[model samples]
Target: MSTAHTALIVPPRLGEPLRVVPVEGPDSLKDLLGGDFESVARGDWHLYLNAEGTTGDLPANLRAAQLMHDCGLDLAGAARGPAVILGRDAKGKDTNIPEHLLRRAEELFGTPQAA
Candidate 1:
Protein backbone atom coordinates (compact mmCIF):
# COMPACT_ATOMS: atom_id res chain seq x y z
CA MET A 1 0.00 0.00 0.00
CA SER A 2 1.07 3.58 -0.55
CA THR A 3 2.36 5.79 2.25
CA ALA A 4 -1.00 7.52 2.17
CA HIS A 5 -2.31 4.56 4.15
CA THR A 6 -0.49 5.81 7.21
CA ALA A 7 -1.03 7.61 10.45
CA LEU A 8 0.00 11.22 10.92
CA ILE A 9 1.01 12.14 14.43
CA VAL A 10 3.92 13.16 16.59
CA PRO A 11 6.60 10.70 17.64
CA PRO A 12 5.77 8.46 20.60
CA ARG A 13 8.08 10.50 22.75
CA LEU A 14 7.28 13.96 23.99
CA GLY A 15 8.61 17.06 22.27
CA GLU A 16 9.12 15.34 18.93
CA PRO A 17 7.87 16.71 15.64
CA LEU A 18 4.91 15.25 13.77
CA ARG A 19 5.33 12.44 11.24
CA VAL A 20 3.47 10.05 8.93
CA VAL A 21 4.12 6.31 8.91
CA PRO A 22 2.53 3.34 7.18
CA VAL A 23 0.14 1.18 9.21
CA GLU A 24 -0.81 -2.03 7.51
CA GLY A 25 -2.99 -3.42 10.30
CA PRO A 26 -3.15 -4.47 13.94
CA ASP A 27 -0.68 -7.29 13.35
CA SER A 28 1.82 -4.85 11.89
CA LEU A 29 1.34 -2.61 14.91
CA LYS A 30 3.46 -4.85 17.15
CA ASP A 31 6.47 -3.95 15.02
CA LEU A 32 5.75 -0.26 15.33
CA LEU A 33 4.92 0.02 19.04
CA GLY A 34 7.24 -2.81 20.06
CA GLY A 35 4.42 -4.64 21.85
CA ASP A 36 0.70 -5.28 21.91
CA PHE A 37 -1.64 -2.60 20.59
CA GLU A 38 -5.23 -1.53 21.14
CA SER A 39 -7.97 0.10 19.08
CA VAL A 40 -9.95 2.96 20.56
CA ALA A 41 -13.09 4.03 18.83
CA ARG A 42 -13.89 7.66 18.34
CA GLY A 43 -16.99 7.92 16.19
CA ASP A 44 -16.44 6.16 12.86
CA TRP A 45 -12.67 6.33 13.32
CA HIS A 46 -10.51 3.80 15.11
CA LEU A 47 -7.22 4.80 16.65
CA TYR A 48 -4.75 1.96 16.84
CA LEU A 49 -2.53 3.51 19.45
CA ASN A 50 0.05 1.66 21.54
CA ALA A 51 -1.57 -0.48 24.21
CA GLU A 52 1.22 -0.22 26.72
CA GLY A 53 1.59 3.49 26.17
CA THR A 54 0.47 4.33 29.69
CA THR A 55 3.31 2.27 31.18
CA GLY A 56 5.70 2.17 28.30
CA ASP A 57 8.64 4.46 27.57
CA LEU A 58 6.45 6.68 25.44
CA PRO A 59 4.52 9.66 26.68
CA ALA A 60 0.86 10.58 26.34
CA ASN A 61 0.02 11.61 22.80
CA LEU A 62 -1.66 14.84 23.82
CA ARG A 63 -1.01 16.59 20.55
CA ALA A 64 -2.47 13.83 18.44
CA ALA A 65 -5.47 13.43 20.70
CA GLN A 66 -6.10 17.15 20.67
CA LEU A 67 -5.98 17.29 16.92
CA MET A 68 -8.41 14.41 16.67
CA HIS A 69 -10.77 16.07 19.09
CA ASP A 70 -10.60 19.25 17.08
CA CYS A 71 -11.44 17.27 13.99
CA GLY A 72 -14.79 16.24 15.58
CA LEU A 73 -13.73 12.84 16.88
CA ASP A 74 -14.88 12.04 20.40
CA LEU A 75 -11.44 11.70 21.92
CA ALA A 76 -11.99 10.97 25.62
CA GLY A 77 -8.47 11.25 26.99
CA ALA A 78 -4.88 11.74 26.05
CA ALA A 79 -3.76 9.14 23.56
CA ARG A 80 -0.53 7.40 24.41
CA GLY A 81 2.22 6.60 21.94
CA PRO A 82 1.88 7.06 18.17
CA ALA A 83 -1.83 6.82 17.32
CA VAL A 84 -2.77 5.34 13.95
CA ILE A 85 -6.08 6.78 12.81
CA LEU A 86 -8.08 4.57 10.49
CA GLY A 87 -11.48 3.97 8.92
CA ARG A 88 -13.31 0.96 7.51
CA ASP A 89 -13.38 0.41 3.79
CA ALA A 90 -16.27 -1.00 1.77
CA LYS A 91 -15.17 -4.51 2.72
CA GLY A 92 -15.05 -3.54 6.39
CA LYS A 93 -11.27 -3.74 6.45
CA ASP A 94 -9.30 -1.15 8.30
CA THR A 95 -7.95 1.48 5.96
CA ASN A 96 -6.45 4.94 5.93
CA ILE A 97 -8.14 7.86 7.59
CA PRO A 98 -10.85 9.31 5.40
CA GLU A 99 -9.88 12.23 3.20
CA HIS A 100 -12.31 14.64 4.82
CA LEU A 101 -11.14 13.74 8.31
CA LEU A 102 -7.51 13.85 7.26
CA ARG A 103 -8.00 17.28 5.82
CA ARG A 104 -9.60 18.45 9.05
CA ALA A 105 -6.77 16.97 11.07
CA GLU A 106 -4.22 18.71 8.88
CA GLU A 107 -6.10 21.94 9.23
CA LEU A 108 -6.30 21.66 13.00
CA PHE A 109 -2.85 20.26 13.68
CA GLY A 110 -1.04 21.29 10.51
CA THR A 111 0.65 18.78 8.21
CA PRO A 112 3.57 16.66 9.30
CA GLN A 113 6.64 18.83 9.66
CA ALA A 114 10.35 18.15 9.68
CA ALA A 115 11.55 16.58 12.85
Candidate 2:
Protein backbone atom coordinates (compact mmCIF):
# COMPACT_ATOMS: atom_id res chain seq x y z
CA MET A 1 0.00 0.00 0.00
CA SER A 2 1.05 3.58 -0.49
CA THR A 3 3.06 4.86 2.48
CA ALA A 4 1.40 8.22 2.14
CA HIS A 5 -0.22 8.88 5.50
CA THR A 6 -2.92 11.33 6.59
CA ALA A 7 -2.31 14.05 9.16
CA LEU A 8 -4.60 16.39 11.08
CA ILE A 9 -4.28 19.21 13.62
CA VAL A 10 -7.72 20.20 14.72
CA PRO A 11 -8.38 23.86 15.47
CA PRO A 12 -7.21 24.45 19.03
CA ARG A 13 -8.86 26.40 21.84
CA LEU A 14 -7.84 28.09 25.15
CA GLY A 15 -6.46 25.05 26.93
CA GLU A 16 -3.44 24.30 24.78
CA PRO A 17 -2.24 23.52 21.29
CA LEU A 18 -2.53 20.05 19.78
CA ARG A 19 0.14 18.26 17.81
CA VAL A 20 -0.28 17.76 14.11
CA VAL A 21 -0.04 13.98 13.93
CA PRO A 22 -0.34 11.81 10.84
CA VAL A 23 -1.80 8.34 10.96
CA GLU A 24 -0.26 5.47 9.04
CA GLY A 25 0.82 1.87 9.34
CA PRO A 26 -1.33 -0.78 11.00
CA ASP A 27 -2.99 1.27 13.71
CA SER A 28 -4.03 4.01 11.34
CA LEU A 29 -7.20 2.19 10.36
CA LYS A 30 -8.05 1.35 13.96
CA ASP A 31 -7.58 4.94 15.03
CA LEU A 32 -10.11 5.84 12.38
CA LEU A 33 -12.58 3.38 13.87
CA GLY A 34 -12.64 5.26 17.21
CA GLY A 35 -9.76 3.38 18.85
CA ASP A 36 -7.07 5.97 19.42
CA PHE A 37 -9.17 9.03 18.63
CA GLU A 38 -12.68 10.35 19.14
CA SER A 39 -14.95 10.47 16.13
CA VAL A 40 -16.06 13.95 15.06
CA ALA A 41 -18.90 14.37 12.60
CA ARG A 42 -18.22 18.01 11.94
CA GLY A 43 -17.57 17.30 8.27
CA ASP A 44 -16.15 14.75 5.87
CA TRP A 45 -12.95 12.69 6.06
CA HIS A 46 -13.90 11.10 9.35
CA LEU A 47 -12.55 13.68 11.82
CA TYR A 48 -10.72 11.90 14.61
CA LEU A 49 -8.01 13.60 16.69
CA ASN A 50 -5.62 12.39 19.36
CA ALA A 51 -6.50 13.25 22.94
CA GLU A 52 -2.93 14.28 23.73
CA GLY A 53 -0.33 16.59 22.19
CA THR A 54 -2.02 19.88 23.06
CA THR A 55 1.28 21.41 24.24
CA GLY A 56 2.84 20.79 20.84
CA ASP A 57 4.14 23.54 18.60
CA LEU A 58 1.07 25.80 18.71
CA PRO A 59 2.24 27.86 15.74
CA ALA A 60 2.50 24.77 13.54
CA ASN A 61 -1.22 24.01 13.62
CA LEU A 62 -2.11 26.08 10.59
CA ARG A 63 0.95 25.06 8.66
CA ALA A 64 0.33 21.39 9.37
CA ALA A 65 -3.32 21.79 8.49
CA GLN A 66 -2.36 23.39 5.24
CA LEU A 67 0.01 20.52 4.57
CA MET A 68 -2.82 18.08 5.08
CA HIS A 69 -4.84 20.01 2.57
CA ASP A 70 -1.95 20.04 0.14
CA CYS A 71 -1.50 16.31 0.60
CA GLY A 72 -5.06 15.79 -0.65
CA LEU A 73 -6.27 14.63 2.74
CA ASP A 74 -9.86 15.14 3.78
CA LEU A 75 -10.46 17.96 6.25
CA ALA A 76 -14.11 18.83 5.84
CA GLY A 77 -14.70 17.26 9.24
CA ALA A 78 -12.06 19.41 10.92
CA ALA A 79 -13.04 21.94 13.51
CA ARG A 80 -13.53 25.50 12.32
CA GLY A 81 -12.61 26.95 15.74
CA PRO A 82 -10.25 25.84 18.50
CA ALA A 83 -10.01 22.08 19.15
CA VAL A 84 -11.99 20.53 21.94
CA ILE A 85 -10.72 17.00 22.75
CA LEU A 86 -7.11 15.85 22.81
CA GLY A 87 -5.53 12.49 23.60
CA ARG A 88 -4.27 14.15 26.76
CA ASP A 89 -2.60 17.25 28.11
CA ALA A 90 1.13 17.96 28.35
CA LYS A 91 1.10 16.12 31.68
CA GLY A 92 -0.72 13.14 30.14
CA LYS A 93 -4.16 13.74 31.62
CA ASP A 94 -7.32 12.92 29.73
CA THR A 95 -9.04 16.32 29.98
CA ASN A 96 -8.28 19.93 30.79
CA ILE A 97 -9.76 22.66 32.96
CA PRO A 98 -13.47 23.52 32.87
CA GLU A 99 -14.40 19.88 33.57
CA HIS A 100 -17.17 20.31 31.07
CA LEU A 101 -14.58 20.25 28.35
CA LEU A 102 -14.30 16.48 28.63
CA ARG A 103 -18.04 16.11 28.54
CA ARG A 104 -18.27 18.33 25.51
CA ALA A 105 -15.52 16.32 23.89
CA GLU A 106 -17.35 13.11 24.65
CA GLU A 107 -20.50 14.55 23.18
CA LEU A 108 -18.93 15.88 20.01
CA PHE A 109 -16.10 13.40 19.56
CA GLY A 110 -18.60 10.60 20.12
CA THR A 111 -16.34 8.62 22.46
CA PRO A 112 -16.63 7.54 26.03
CA GLN A 113 -14.87 9.83 28.49
CA ALA A 114 -11.70 8.47 30.03
CA ALA A 115 -11.91 7.26 33.57
Candidate 3:
Protein backbone atom coordinates (compact mmCIF):
# COMPACT_ATOMS: atom_id res chain seq x y z
CA MET A 1 0.00 0.00 0.00
CA SER A 2 1.05 3.59 -0.65
CA THR A 3 1.02 6.38 1.85
CA ALA A 4 0.97 10.00 0.79
CA HIS A 5 -0.38 13.32 1.90
CA THR A 6 -3.40 14.22 -0.16
CA ALA A 7 -4.55 17.74 -0.98
CA LEU A 8 -8.21 18.61 -1.27
CA ILE A 9 -9.55 21.42 -3.44
CA VAL A 10 -13.20 22.34 -3.01
CA PRO A 11 -14.39 24.78 -5.60
CA PRO A 12 -15.57 27.97 -4.05
CA ARG A 13 -19.03 29.36 -4.30
CA LEU A 14 -19.51 32.55 -6.28
CA GLY A 15 -17.36 35.31 -4.79
CA GLU A 16 -16.01 33.01 -2.09
CA PRO A 17 -12.42 32.04 -1.45
CA LEU A 18 -11.03 28.85 -2.92
CA ARG A 19 -10.81 25.92 -0.49
CA VAL A 20 -7.55 24.02 -0.21
CA VAL A 21 -7.77 21.51 2.58
CA PRO A 22 -5.23 18.78 3.35
CA VAL A 23 -6.53 15.24 3.47
CA GLU A 24 -4.89 12.98 6.04
CA GLY A 25 -5.90 9.47 4.97
CA PRO A 26 -8.24 7.29 2.97
CA ASP A 27 -10.86 7.39 5.69
CA SER A 28 -11.41 11.06 5.01
CA LEU A 29 -12.21 10.44 1.37
CA LYS A 30 -15.73 9.38 2.18
CA ASP A 31 -16.24 12.43 4.34
CA LEU A 32 -14.95 14.79 1.69
CA LEU A 33 -16.11 13.17 -1.54
CA GLY A 34 -19.20 11.52 -0.14
CA GLY A 35 -20.42 8.02 -0.95
CA ASP A 36 -18.70 7.31 -4.26
CA PHE A 37 -15.52 8.62 -5.87
CA GLU A 38 -13.64 8.59 -9.14
CA SER A 39 -10.17 9.49 -10.35
CA VAL A 40 -8.68 11.34 -13.30
CA ALA A 41 -5.04 11.64 -14.27
CA ARG A 42 -3.65 15.11 -14.66
CA GLY A 43 -0.02 15.02 -15.66
CA ASP A 44 1.99 13.24 -12.98
CA TRP A 45 -0.79 13.47 -10.45
CA HIS A 46 -4.06 11.62 -9.98
CA LEU A 47 -7.10 13.77 -9.29
CA TYR A 48 -9.96 12.22 -7.37
CA LEU A 49 -13.48 13.55 -7.57
CA ASN A 50 -16.97 12.75 -6.29
CA ALA A 51 -18.64 10.30 -8.63
CA GLU A 52 -21.85 12.27 -8.51
CA GLY A 53 -20.31 15.66 -9.05
CA THR A 54 -21.60 15.89 -12.57
CA THR A 55 -25.20 15.14 -11.66
CA GLY A 56 -24.93 16.73 -8.28
CA ASP A 57 -24.43 20.29 -7.11
CA LEU A 58 -20.81 20.60 -8.11
CA PRO A 59 -19.94 23.35 -10.54
CA ALA A 60 -17.11 23.52 -12.99
CA ASN A 61 -13.87 23.90 -11.04
CA LEU A 62 -12.29 26.59 -13.16
CA ARG A 63 -10.07 27.95 -10.41
CA ALA A 64 -8.51 24.54 -9.83
CA ALA A 65 -7.82 24.01 -13.50
CA GLN A 66 -6.27 27.47 -13.63
CA LEU A 67 -4.16 26.71 -10.59
CA MET A 68 -2.80 23.54 -12.13
CA HIS A 69 -2.28 25.26 -15.45
CA ASP A 70 -0.34 28.08 -13.83
CA CYS A 71 1.87 25.53 -12.17
CA GLY A 72 2.66 24.07 -15.62
CA LEU A 73 0.67 20.91 -14.95
CA ASP A 74 -1.15 19.54 -17.94
CA LEU A 75 -4.86 18.99 -17.45
CA ALA A 76 -6.43 15.84 -18.85
CA GLY A 77 -10.02 17.08 -18.56
CA ALA A 78 -12.21 19.67 -16.92
CA ALA A 79 -12.63 19.32 -13.17
CA ARG A 80 -15.85 19.46 -11.20
CA GLY A 81 -16.80 19.45 -7.53
CA PRO A 82 -14.27 18.87 -4.76
CA ALA A 83 -10.98 17.25 -5.79
CA VAL A 84 -8.01 15.43 -4.31
CA ILE A 85 -4.54 15.47 -5.84
CA LEU A 86 -2.05 12.72 -5.10
CA GLY A 87 1.28 11.71 -6.56
CA ARG A 88 3.05 8.39 -7.09
CA ASP A 89 6.61 7.66 -6.01
CA ALA A 90 9.36 5.65 -7.75
CA LYS A 91 7.80 2.44 -6.51
CA GLY A 92 4.52 3.50 -8.08
CA LYS A 93 3.05 4.06 -4.68
CA ASP A 94 1.04 7.10 -3.70
CA THR A 95 3.11 10.02 -2.44
CA ASN A 96 2.70 13.59 -1.47
CA ILE A 97 1.41 16.07 -3.97
CA PRO A 98 4.43 18.40 -4.19
CA GLU A 99 4.53 20.94 -1.37
CA HIS A 100 5.44 23.77 -3.71
CA LEU A 101 2.41 23.12 -5.84
CA LEU A 102 0.07 23.19 -2.88
CA ARG A 103 1.80 26.29 -1.54
CA ARG A 104 1.45 28.05 -4.84
CA ALA A 105 -2.24 27.19 -5.01
CA GLU A 106 -2.85 28.61 -1.57
CA GLU A 107 -0.94 31.78 -2.37
CA LEU A 108 -2.96 32.28 -5.51
CA PHE A 109 -6.42 31.12 -4.49
CA GLY A 110 -6.63 30.95 -0.73
CA THR A 111 -8.32 34.31 -0.32
CA PRO A 112 -11.29 36.09 -1.74
CA GLN A 113 -10.85 38.40 -4.69
CA ALA A 114 -11.99 41.98 -5.09
CA ALA A 115 -15.15 42.46 -7.03
How many residue pairs of model 3 clash at the backbone?
0
Query: What TM-score does candidate 3 get on C-alpha atoms?
Result: 0.64
Candidate 3 residue runs with Cα over 4 Å from true position: 1-6, 14-25, 71-77, 111-115
Tens digits of per-residue lDDT for model 3, 34-112: 6578775544566677788768867777766677677575544456666666665666545667666667667876742
Question: What 10-residue stretch in candidate 1 is worst by lDDT?
Answer: 1-10
**Stretches of model 1 off by over 4 angstroms after superposition:** 1-4, 13-15, 71-78, 90-92, 113-115
List model 1 lDDT by residue over 11-93, tens digit each: 55556656666676556666666678877655556667777777775667777777667766655655777776677566556
Q: What is the TM-score of each candidate against the true structure?
A: 0.70, 0.25, 0.64
Residue 13 miss distance in model 1 (angstroms)? 4.6
Model 2 C-alpha lDDT per residue in residues 9-106, reported as the tens digit of each score = 34444344333344454365345322344444322233445433343322233422443354355555342333322233455333222234333433
Model 1, residue 105: C-alpha shift (Å): 2.0
Candidate with the greatest lDDT versus the true structure: 1
**Clash counts for the predictions, in order:** 0, 13, 0
* Whole-model Cα lDDT of every candidate shown, in order: 0.65, 0.37, 0.62
> What are the C-alpha RMSDs, in order, of all predicted structures?
3.5, 15.1, 4.9
Candidates ranked by TM-score, best first?
A: 1, 3, 2
In model 2, the Cα lDDT at residue 112 comes to 34
